[model samples]
Target: MSDQPRSYLVLASQRSGSTLLVESLRTTGQAGEPQEFFQYLPSTSLAPQPREWFAGVDDENILRLLAPWKPGTPSMETPQEWRARILDAGRTPNGVWGGKLMWNQTPLLTAWADGLAGRQADDPDAGDLKTAIEDVLGPDVLLVHVARKDTVAQAVSMWRAVQTQVWRGRADPEVDARAEYNADGIAHLHAILEDQERQWARWFGEAGVEPLEIDYHELASDTTGQVARVLVALGLDPELAPPPALQRQGNDRSNDWIERYRAERISV
Candidate 1:
């Protein structure tokens, strides 16, 4: 590895095929333990639960399909402590660190950064989303944006995963068997995801940061190649990037949902 920045973050929305890239990099044992570190909700101290994703819809049918909420224990760690833990957890033996962040989790990250500022004797220059990330990950971190062009398919995949609570691997047949497709739920996620992609674009424009862009179609089609690209961007040997280890989660049910959503959305 060259003396380039040893840390990187994957920026994406849910179901954007980011896991494929991060997990592929992780298998190489050179990359840091990349994870969705910012996805946990402050209230529950857990990754967004199935029902939490559908925040405002009053549709009982949608609610009933999702897994019931469990009140998770709130984290008691201070911002400094949380930062220390994350930094430590994400780092590799060679000091490279990797993590993933989503647009929706920006508020949580910023809030914790505020807490970090409060804990410091002198206030750190924590202001906006970009600054907050810099505060936590340092200024030299590489940003990679992974996005999916198919909003319907992405949202539909998310919709199914939300119901089954399985975001990885060949999903359990018993659990996924219970997951029902609802156009409204998928549409709700579709709007949120589309808006998130827009927000990422707007923020990138405003921040004047050109992140390494990874398209989902391309990433999914060439997982190892994409991982190699990221490794090269990080100034590491591209050969260290390993073969793809994850199985694609999309299936016939997901494709059907995507088509159904597109049809319904077009007619209405």
Candidate 2:
């Protein structure tokens, strides 16, 4: 095998079943850990709260809360260090690395990619986001664009996630919160999802990156087949036995929320 690492990215939007895809890839063991390495960007946008709320909290504490990975760990201080750490952590024993990035996180992704390529954060020569990513991760990096075909379902899922702030299940107990149906809120989320999809398309076109497009519905239906497809795309052995089933994350309230929104719209 070539000395260069085989890297790939799952390009997706919120509530697009990306977590499922990433977990499937990760379980393969041949595929590296694919996670939201740039999640800190979104955390940085957290709304300002009262000073008393964070009183006596150190910067490290704040970073630990905001960062996806354990903060204050070695090589976790600067963005560059974090990128290196993530890439190293994600690398498989076979030298394969995988990551998942959302379309809306362009700024953070660009900066991380630039750092990987040893360029200044705002380097103009870094080119577009795709180019920058390719520069660091290698030109042959596989791109998997996962999208949700059901816009209404995707929007409602995102809305509920935002409302409850419970994106995934953990060992810790979580307060189950049912999402209230708001036609206008769902509509706005739907529009944002549509716009982000368009942006991904435009970015792929401009960057001349031909991505393996996968749908959320199909992924949910036949996860094994979808994962095999991704493996094959990355020039890996598709004949290998599939990984164990991935545990479902989100609750099953999206469909009900969508129905309620439709009913409300019709009544309006």
Candidate 3:
């Protein structure tokens, strides 16, 4: 392995099988632990909530709420310290670092990246998400864009997850609950996914980045092949054995929820 670390970003939207991909990549022990490293950042919001809920909340309270999501991160560390630690810890013995980020988390990432480069927090030049990423990762950082081809399914998944507060397995029991279907909410989520996809396409065009795109369906069907493809894209040895199987999270409940939402929309 080269002395200089190889870095990559897994750009994805919510409920897009990104977790599966990240877990698989991590199993290789070569791809690095590419998780939502910026998740604990103050401005990071995984779901929509009324602003009033956080009116009197300080950073400590926010960190407490974020504890369940961010593993291996101490609650006492400041955001800047957490950012630095995450980058260092994400690297594997093979000198490869990987990270996954959703489009909605871009603001927090941009701010962290700006600080890394010693750029002004509000600098327009520092505002470019791609540039900010490369500033810290390196100039030739590879990007893998993972998306769910079925917008309806993806939207339903996001809607259900937001309602249930169960984005993955082993979630807090206190937040575990069955999700209710909402036609308007599902439709809104679908629109948001479409807009986010378009935004990603636009950014790729502007940045001249031809990212390796992975479909959620294909990834589920052939995890090894997809992982190999990602390895090859990152100039790693593709012959490496696939990682151990990950515990599947979603189930028939998601499909049931989708059907319920579809029927509700039709009736309206």
Top lDDT model? 1
Q: Write the per-residue lDDT of candidate 3 for residues 139-218, one digit (tens) a residue.
A: 87778999887888898777656655667664454554534555666676787788778888888899888888999888
TM-score of predicted model 2? 0.76
By summed lDDT, the worst window of 10 consecutive residues in model 3 runs over 61-70
What lDDT does each candidate get? 0.88, 0.70, 0.72
Question: Over the full model, what C-alpha lDDT does candidate 1 score relative to the true structure?
Answer: 0.88
Pick the winner on lDDT between candidates 1 and 3. Answer: 1
- Per-residue lDDT of 112 in model 1: 88
Candidate 2 yields a Cα-based lDDT of 0.70
TM-scores of the candidates are: 0.95, 0.76, 0.78
Number of clashes in model 1?
0
Flag the better candidate by TM-score, 1 or 2.
Answer: 1
Task: Sort the candidates on TM-score, descending order.
Answer: 1, 3, 2
Task: Report the lDDT tens digits of candidate 1 across residue range 1-268.
Answer: 5668899999999999889888998888888999889988777789988877888889998999988889998888888889999999998998889999999999888888878866342555544788888889988989999999988899998998898888899778998899998888988999999999999999999999899999999988888789999999888889987777799888888888788878889565
* Error in Å for residue 247 of model 1: 0.4
